[model samples]
Target: MSDQQPTGSDLSPPGESTSDTSPSRTAQLKRWAALDTTSGALLLTAATIAVVWANSPWRDSYQDLLEIEFGPAALHLHLSLADWIADGMLAIFFFVVGVELKHEFVAGTLRDFKLAGVPIVAALGGMIVPAACYVAVVGIGDPEALGGWAIPTATDIAFALAVLAIFGRGLPVALRTFLLTLAVVDDLLGITVIATFYTDTINLPALLGALVAVAVFAVLVRMARRWWLLLLPVALTAWTLMHASGVHATIAGVLLGFSVPAVAMRGERMPRTEWFDETIRPYSAAVALPVFAFAAAGVTVVGTSGIIQPVSIGIMLGLVVGKVVGVLAFTALMVRFTPLRLPDSIGLRDLLPVGMLTGVGFTVALLIAELSFEVGSDSHAAAAKAAILAGSVVSAAIAAVLLRWDARQLRDPDMNRDGIPDVDRDVIGG
Candidate 1:
């Protein structure tokens, strides 16, 4: 089935519309993209600085800051800076994820399952087999460690999109679509993992409070017709309640994201000059994602002493090796034996390295590390951080190089695959 493109103002939620042809609309989009890129660049720079500082004489200060405790008198919440990023800033990331998820389901790619099949299958392949491999090898003895299994189950959306952008027009548009689809499914899996595995011994009061918030949010969403400013405050309240309830605060972010009404602004008309979604959604993607990336990507790496510990080794290997093997192997088998053609632009050769790149699990890996790190095992947590750093660096470098090579091939202008020209090929390769 061909994917349904969102169109016509009738689909607009009541009041959302704008003049798409206006120069202002284009300028707004450009601004949004600029914000995304700048924030993304900052994140990359911050991560690099963290790595350098962790190894330098400033390493002590770096470690100290992350470990420094700050909280209140009566409530007495204590956590390191790293923990603050992992558990706190990350909730915002999940909140965004929830928004994206809702958008897709309501109006975007997953609007039809057949159109969504390729990436859905690919993401499932990417997640399930790696986890099975991890559990089979070392999962027999400790069930607590089972929480770590979900670590390899996600794809880093920012990194994937960055890789695609580098390839430019040499890749297929379908590739981006497929990758986006895959990441969405992959994130959903990660959410399930957190909900099912990473919770503290359940607290009834907290759960009840969460349920109440969810109910109230739903009621507000349905009844309140205006594009309400209440979203931010309500989301914050939900985050606090989730935190207090002992549920992962990040989940609260997701729930709040869902509650945010996508209702059209008041005094709007169908098929108007501006579309509400196109206007507001890109800001989240371009600005919010990159900031989250920069804030979450950095992990101070000092003292090589315990950096190569067993848990670290497992995580690194799982992300670097496990993702590639599982995703590629499953995809290969599916295309080979079944009717689903390998995306027309990707042959077995090109697919191999792309699979390898999917292993570049930076953002998701950090999230899983936070979820896995139980109380008092700071060293274990540190090891997980080190492993993510090492694995992501290696995966990103290798994948970037290989993708560049493939992109060059697709861009040669002289070569065509099975009657398809280079320009068309580039879009697919993306």
Candidate 2:
């Protein structure tokens, strides 16, 4: 063999570079996972800083910055930069959610009913039971508290994943997969709740405008084929229409997402590249989520009364109690009555920790917190935030410990791996 070995043409035919720049799909996935990890760390860091800053001597400036007002007189609208960021920036977040929902429904996890059933049921139970708990405690007594119904209804994927990672080697990757799938579906429920229960007075003209814009978007999305560029203008236009209409602007994300071409493949051929799915998810989860967390997590609780208020109590209870009962109970029933079975990698003991992690509802909870106090009730908002922060932290901590311990046992290798039957790992993960 020559010392130089085989060069491009010799190694593989023409057009092949020795440099390997074609981008290994595995490498890309690893990189995305790493970024997700980092984003989660950043969110935790930002949240810590927000709590510290809110309680520090510099708290006034922080509060003032959040409340600073600025807007135009054209439509006669004005709100503090904080409100705009919390409400407005969050609409984009919802847009991302819509896209994800569409993606999942079209070709992702929700693609097959057999695979989708467990998560779908778990997510529904998780949401409904929590809402029921909140209602039983507050919503029924005073319907005003009903806005808080969506408070405990979501699971933050970042936080949940991070907790799973902390458990390290022992986690039966199946449990992680199940949790992720459940969170995605739970997010869908949260979005529907926002659209159905959260709107104010509907402006028909504006609503009609939004519908027309959505139709235009559908046309553009279909015509553009795999073109990612087309989505930008259409998304903005949808946002404008949604904002003008009485509908929550965040639903625009769902619309845009649904309009995206998820079924790009037809018959034997791969449809165009899955650029949007591959590219957008990492960008949203890494960059958009952290930025949103930084802007949204800042709240002042320093000089205020330390007692956990009713709103906070409701949120904390709804998440901590509701999620655990809902997920476990539904899963238990499925395992008992139906032919469905737990992933071979998971054990009966592992369910509790995973269930605890399901209570980490940062993103959606924050959005609902904004809605619960959109009328500018400080006590109500603060209480809601406190509850969310507390519940998320407690749930994550408990889950982390439980998962870590479970991981240790899982790595033992002596444990039986019966009934697995070697199905594709992604199916369970989904």
Candidate 3:
């Protein structure tokens, strides 16, 4: 009956060590890195199409397409294309995120609270500071704009990782690991905010139904039975009820993901969580995320003036300025004043670019923006979208330059006669 999990490294066959140099381990890492890069490219392409379609002469068609609604209204399923992308397809993406989060907690660096505390605290500072910066700028002038404060608190991991994979070829592994951890924690916080603040009136009966379904799903998963045919309907039912219950449907994805076992049973070859992740991750990244980006990122910029509104300015500053300052400052303070220590392979200077990369608040930020403003508030929505796009681009540019500089610095002579460069050795060992 116990679902308690072993660490990730323990998922390997009982006789094999989880050495990075192992052919299987290296191949797995390469596959994941390749997938990340491909997803990033897909996201960029989708985002580009959205922006172009939004501003082109055929913009009306784009709007019409998104607004086109179908499905059974009686079942509370009638929704626009945009809504389907956000509420339906993005659930798949979040499910993968949930799997990754569970893996990290069960076996990754986050398995140790002392090692994990740095990024956890950095994520907190990252979220809080951007929110404060956003509110301070827009909330003071227009109280109604305060709702958008959460928009800047998100960090788009796919976009950020794309930048790292391109520019951080020779950088320390610890840097990428740190960024991944930070972004995951940030997503957790953003989801919490959505479930807590963005939700309106709740339907308690529907919510109770959803919770019951979730419990059932968890029990079935714990049994290690291949009941996807049955479980799929239960999952969808939970998601539908959650949607009807005034909670975001993606939360259903996370809850369902948590139910899957993270460790293999005695006769199993792989953990169910890892197996599910490997099977579903491609669809999540290559299909679900791109579609969501295409639906969500299209915002017509009227002109430069639209991009300079108080709300837009607040979003831009919060993302580009507040994120970097908050992450770096808090990380430094913790290492200096507390018992926490930075990973040996990474130094304070390295975090500057890492902090900057955290500023790319693309996907989830867009979702928050949508929730923050009324549909009729076209001006505000357009402005905020412009700010998110601009801030992310600017942050990526800065992070690229800083990472290149760091790579160059790592080229210094290696006094040790080891075949591997000192920097590489440090990164791999760490």
Best by TM-score: 3
For model 3, state the Cα shift of residue 301 in Å. Answer: 1.5
Tens-digit lDDT string for candidate 2 (154-250): 8887778776765534455566667767888888888888778878788888778777777777776666345546667767777766777877777
lDDT of 3 by residue, 1-430 (tens): 0112233454344324566543455445434533667778989899999999988988879889999999889989999988888899999988877887887788666789787888889999899999999999997766778889999999998889889878987777767888988899999889899889999889999999999999988877666355555788999989999999999899989888877777777467667777667656667777888999898888876443555788988999999999999899898889878887766467677788889999999989988898888653466888888899999999999999998898767433332223334453444222
Tell me the number of clashing residue pairs for each predicted model: 20, 4, 0
- lDDT of model number 2: 0.67
Candidate 3: residue 251 Cα off by (Å): 1.0
- lDDT (Cα, tens digit) per residue for candidate 1, span 199-255: 867677866787677667656654535624664566566666677777777887677
- List residue ranges in candidate 1 displaced over 4 A: 1-39, 68-81, 136-146, 222-227, 260-301, 336-350, 374-376, 410-430
Q: Order candidates by lDDT, high to low.
A: 3, 2, 1
CA lDDT of each prediction against the hidden true structure? 0.61, 0.67, 0.80
Report how far residue 15 has shifted in candidate 1, in Å. Answer: 3.6
Best model number under lDDT = 3
